[model samples]
Target: MADPKGFMTTPRQEWPRRPVEERVRDWHEVYVPGALLPIVSKQADRCMDCGIPFCHHACPLGNLIPEWNDLVSREDWRAASDRLHATNNFPEFTGRLCPAPCEAGCVLAINQPAVTIKNVECAIADRAWEEGFTSPRPPERLSGRTVAVIGSGPTGLAAAQQLTRAGHTVAVYERDDRLGGLMRYGIPAFKMEKHHLERRLEQMRAEGTKFRPSTAVGQDIGAAELRSRYDAVVVATGATAWRELPVPGRELAGVHQAMEYLPQANRVCEGDLEVSPLSAAGKHVVIVGGGDTGADCLGTAVREGAASVTQLDIYAQPGTERDEDAEPWPTYPKLYRLSAAHEEARDLGTAPAADADARLFAASTLRFGGDAEGRVRRLHLVEVDAGRRPVPGSERTLPADLVLLALGFSGPDRSDGLVDQLGLELEPRGTLARDAGFATNVPGVFAAGDAARGQSLIVWAIAEGRAVAAAVDRYLTGRSRLPAPISPYDRPMTV
Candidate 1:
């Protein structure tokens, strides 16, 4: 152990974020650059090195949390980076995007604050890149097998990287003009800058993993033709068919889905556009959801200089503390947590109609009202009960110039014709049907990530990617050394 009494002696501290006033003016990440490296060692020392190590169970990738924590606490950066990369292919992405369920399940979190696992992971990853610890690991010999992976999201990228390292010739096909999928366009720069993605892509290219950007599989190359060309095909297209709000006045102008708005702002950052056409500048915006996507919208609108921004959650506000009767410890509980975006909205007083955090709990949308030009002007809603039933005499309206529906996604968008072209079967919930080994009904075609698992955390996507790569590897050769970290039936631990 790095320190026997470190858990008792040290307190938990997180990476400091940039000032709201300073961050809202720029598109860079919200965290202060290089601030995490200083305090992360002390935080990692707080890991207790539990006997059970529930943090491992909490993580879908089975990340070696305690081992890496010990390494970091001892200032063994090289060992820590090796341990961190043993399971997760993209620690930087997970460090920035994951909600850190491992921290929630920390043995220390049964009482005191958990160790800063996410920050430590990020620090290790960043230091690895800076110190030249990360380099191209090309295969020693060719397997004489080829694999084509559809979609260049986290899942597809992870799978392609693993397969290529195992000596299989792998090519990743992305519909977008660039790789990284959502990380390229869906996620805003304020969350994670694009250079991190570019550097990783460079490593993959050097390692012999081919990339085919702007090539839609079902359209540019038919699925059958792709299967015929490659020995195996892996479909990692993410779930992107957004759920819509069917409420009245849905056809009004200036109303769009969260996916529709986020990409435009990202394009502006990518220099593809001078400014977003759906920019929230000088407009009153109302977001209809309380998930991470809604919070992303809240931050984007604030940066865009929206006149006001309010987020609506259909469920009642959760208590600050976990309820033992409802959601016990060791499982991720529903609690009132303040994200950086909500902090910005609260401090700036952007949504005066809602609570201090600019969030309305137990709120249900009824309809939208528009002006003569068919532009959304106001949103009509009512207070709701725990069951989402409208309360009797609590209706209200708020001025809303822009309406963004962050209701989440359903499944892979079939409009590209990938699924139909492959003659693949889908689950009842719209996800691609897969067996225990992540294989679809079609023989050589496999599915993973959101396309097979539905919308899930980024960690889960990478885990599924690695697991599917193992399955595909085993199929090509009778035996394989690839590791599968998770199964198709493994669901997130819940009470």
Candidate 2:
């Protein structure tokens, strides 16, 4: 360990976000560009490099956090970048998007603040990009095996890159007009700009990974035909079948799913649309479900100049600090976090003035009130007890020009017939079922990411992608040398 006592000397610090007023006016990430570079080494010093290193266990990717931390502390950025890329195929995406379970499991988090691992991670990834350390690593020998990977999301991209680097001719098929799948359309530009994705796509293309966009299997091309054409197939299609809010007046025209609303805004960011079809501008929006997706909707609405925004949650408000009695150390604790979106909402005075939180805890939507034109106009809600039962005399109505169901996704969309055409088995939870090796029931067919694991974080998706690639490699050849990060059914602790 470089500077063994560095953890005691350096206090945990993070990148300062741009002021809400200035950032909300534009569709750029909230952080000041190049903000983390200056403090990342100091923050990296805070890693204690604990003997057990619970961060490793917590991370779905099993990233070498302490090693990278020490390397950064010693000013070995090249080594740090190498270590970062050793396990993760796309640290840039995870650094910006992951909830940072590794920080939650940090030893320092047991008492004081955790090490700024995520910021350091993002800094390392950015440094690598700036220094041209990341380049096309096309394999020397061709394995002569052709693989078709469905979806261009994190999982599919990681798998395609790994397979390509392993000398397999890998073609990534994306249904969208552009690649990156949800990374291109599901995520907003404010959370992550598109250039980062484009840079990685360029690197992948240069590395012999072929991309086929504006096409989908089982629809554009028959699933049976794709399976027959490629020696092997990896289905990395993500869980996108959004969960519905089954309440009264659910069919109102103005009431839409979060996915329906989010993707439209993302498309506008891509210059595909002048404006989102369901723009939240001048609307009093009520988001149902207080999750990350709901927060995303809240941010998007703020940028669209929504008159007012309120998000409701069925669960009671969690504590700001960790409750050690309920959630002991070494496990990811569900302490309340102020995401960039929530911070923006608080600054705009849209959140409750008391705590500057837009979330109304223990709240349940009873029904919707639509105008004569069948467009939603207002929302009916009730205060709920711990058991989620409606509290007496708590019914109220709020002005809502638009209602967004940010209730999260159930599983992958099957309307494209990917599952039915391939005769893939599904788990009880509606996700594709897979074996220990990440292989589906049908031979030569494999599944990973949200398709097999259900809706999960980007970190998990990348890990699933890497593991599935290894599994497919072993299947294609009598023996393989690829590293498998996790088992098919291995899941991280939910925070």
Candidate 3:
């Protein structure tokens, strides 16, 4: 161990976010550049390197956390990066986007705060890039097998890279005009700039992974044709269908799904649109759903100069700390978190706002009220009981010029014609059904990521991609040497 008493002597210190006022004014990431490096070593020293190291099990990628922690604590960033990258294809993406369940399983977290594993990871990745430790690892030989990977999201991208290194000629097909799937379009640049994604894509291209953006398999090329053209086909299309609020006034103008609103803002950032079609500027915005997607809407509304913002959650607010009885140690705790968006909302005097932000807990929407122009102007809501049923005589009207249904996605968009064309079987949950090896009923076709697993973390998506790639490799070559992080049937503890 780097320091025997490090956990006790050095208290946990996390990376400091940029000042709220300064960060919210622009689309840059919230962190102060290079600010976490000095403290990361100390935090890394706090890792107990437990006898069992449950952190590994906690991560979907099964990242070698303790090993990298020891390396970082000893100031061996190169080795730390190597260990970090051994499992995860993109630590930079996960370090920024993933809600670190690994920390929950930290041995130190049984009593004290967990080591800042995520922060250390981000530090190691950033340092690697700065020091030129990260580079393209082109395969030594070509396998002469061609593989078609559908979707350019984390999973597909990871699989393509892994397969490319396995000497397979991999072609990543993205439906979107640009690559990176949700990373490039769904997520706001404020959380993560597109440049990070572009750089990685450049690296992948250099490593012999070919990208075919704006080319959807079912649309541009027939699914059967794609399967026939390639030795193996891996479908990594993510869940794109937004869950709807089917209450009365659903047809009212100004009521939009969070995805509908979020992507426009992201497109505006890409300079594709002069102005977003559904901007919240000068309007009172009500975000329904209290998950990360809802928080994202809240942040976007704030930046777009919304007159007011209110976020509502049907469920009661989570406890600030872990519930020991309900959620034991070594398991991810259900706790309240102030995300970057929530923090921004608070800074803007919204409900999470210390002085102004508006959040309504245990609230349920009743209906929408529109003006003569058929434009929504108000929302009918009520305080709900623990069952989420409205309490009698608790109905009230709140001004809501724009209402975003931040309720999460249900499954992949079946309307895309891809599923129908492929005649893919779906599970009861409406996700594509895959067997133990992430293969669909069709011999040469396989599915992975959110499309197959439903809405999940980026880390899991990438893991699925890498694992599915191994399955595809095995099918193509009769036996594979690629590492499979997890099986299609393997459900993580966090999930």
Candidate 4:
């Protein structure tokens, strides 16, 4: 403990975000520069250093939360970074993207607001990068084993990094033109700039992880051929099949899946694309989904100068406070969240200015009404009950020139021929099926991340990747020393 009475003396101070009006005009991150470092030490000192440290159990990556909190509080950023990287291969990514279930599960959160675990984490990572504490750790000796990892998402990258560090020659294959998978194109710059992803890729490359981008495994290299070439094959291809809206006017122009819209905006931000084909400029955008993806679209549209933006959710609005019965202490609560995009929308007065952005809950999109040219012009909607059945006489029409379906993903896209060509079996839920060790029915082929577990947090993907790497190591060498963060049956304490 940095100061015995620190928790009692220092009140929690959250990171300050950039002013909503100013941030909405550009694609920069939401938080103000150097805004977190000053308060982070005191906030980190608030950690109780609990007897059991429930935050570790809460985080899928099992980050050493209290230890790092102690380190940060003591201003030992290098030590904090080391502790953080012990379990999580990409702290910067998780620090930015994770919802911080670890903070929710903090023993302090049983009463007062939790210690700023996530903020401390981000600060440590940022400091490490600035101070040159982060470097590649190439193994001293070769294990004379080779592994093929499909997909370059968080899981695949983490697995490849871990395996390479364990002295296995690893090749990471991505269908995208660049590595980092969704981190490269799916996530918008406002959430986390792409440089973070790029830097990590550079480190992995220096550590002897070979990257093969723009190579679709099932199409370019047959799955059988890939298996034959490597001692073990790990499938970390994330779930890519978007959950689509099957409503009447889905075929109308301007209607597109969230994945379809988000990538174009991200590519444009990268300066690789001169213009996005589905630019939201001067259009009335209606996003059908009130999740993170929808929030992402909202921010993108606002940056693109959309005339108006509205996000709709079929479910009723979550309570402002925790739902105690449904979500007990130490479990992640279903509470209203104000994302950065929501803040920007609120400032713009695009929808209900008073109510924090243009979000409509308990709403259902009935159909799309289009112009004579078959372009989406309006959206038909109705208020619905908990059962999602239409409420009596609540029909309405909302103008929309662009419709983004942010309904979330279902499973991996099998169309690329990866699963079919590999003859891999999928679970009933459409995710790739795996045994106790993350191994598919086919010998030497293992699956992890969203490809096997469905869409989830980045932390979970990295954890699964590490665990699957250990499994693949065992399969290749008959025994292994790699750490398996969580067993398939392990239930993460989600707070």
lDDT of 1 by residue, 1-495 (tens): 788888899888899999999999999999998899999988888999989999999999999999999999888999999999999999999999899999889999988998899999999999999999999999999999999999999999999999999999999999999899888888888988999899999999999999999999999989899999999999999999999999999999988999999999999999999989999999999999999999999999999999999999998999888787887778988889999899999999999889659799999999999999999999999999988899999999999999999999999999989999999999999999999989999999999999999999999999999999999999999777998999988988898
Q: By the lDDT metric, which is better: model 1 or model 3?
A: 1
Q: Could you give candidate 3's per-residue lDDT for residues 1-495 as a string of tens digits?
A: 899889989999989989988887887888988789989999998998889999998898999998999999999989999999999999999988889989998989988999898899889988998889888999999999999999999999999999999999999999889999889878888878888898899999999999899987788888888888898888888998888888888888999998889989999999999889999999989999988888888888888889889998888777778888878877788787788888778766754322224568788999999989888998888989989888999887888899999888777787657888888999998999989989898888899999999999988999998899888888888899888989877776743
| Between candidates 2 and 3, the lDDT winner | 2
Q: Please, what is the whole-model Cα lDDT of each candidate in the order they appear?
A: 0.94, 0.90, 0.88, 0.89
- Model 2, which residues run further than 4 Å from truth? 351-355
Best by lDDT: 1
Name the runs in model 4 displaced over 4 angstroms: 353-356
Clashes of each: 0, 0, 9, 0
TM-score for each candidate, following the candidate numbering = 0.99, 0.98, 0.97, 0.98
Clashing residue pairs for model 1: none
Candidate 3 vs. truth: CA RMSD? 1.7
lDDT, residue 451, model 3: 92
Candidate topping TM-score? 1
Stretches of candidate 1 above 4 Å error?
Answer: none
lDDT (tens digit, per residue) of candidate 2 on 183-269: 888788999999999999999999999999999888999999999999999999999999988889999989999888999999888
Q: Which residue pairs clash within candidate 4?
A: none
Model 1 lDDT, residue 328, Cα: 74
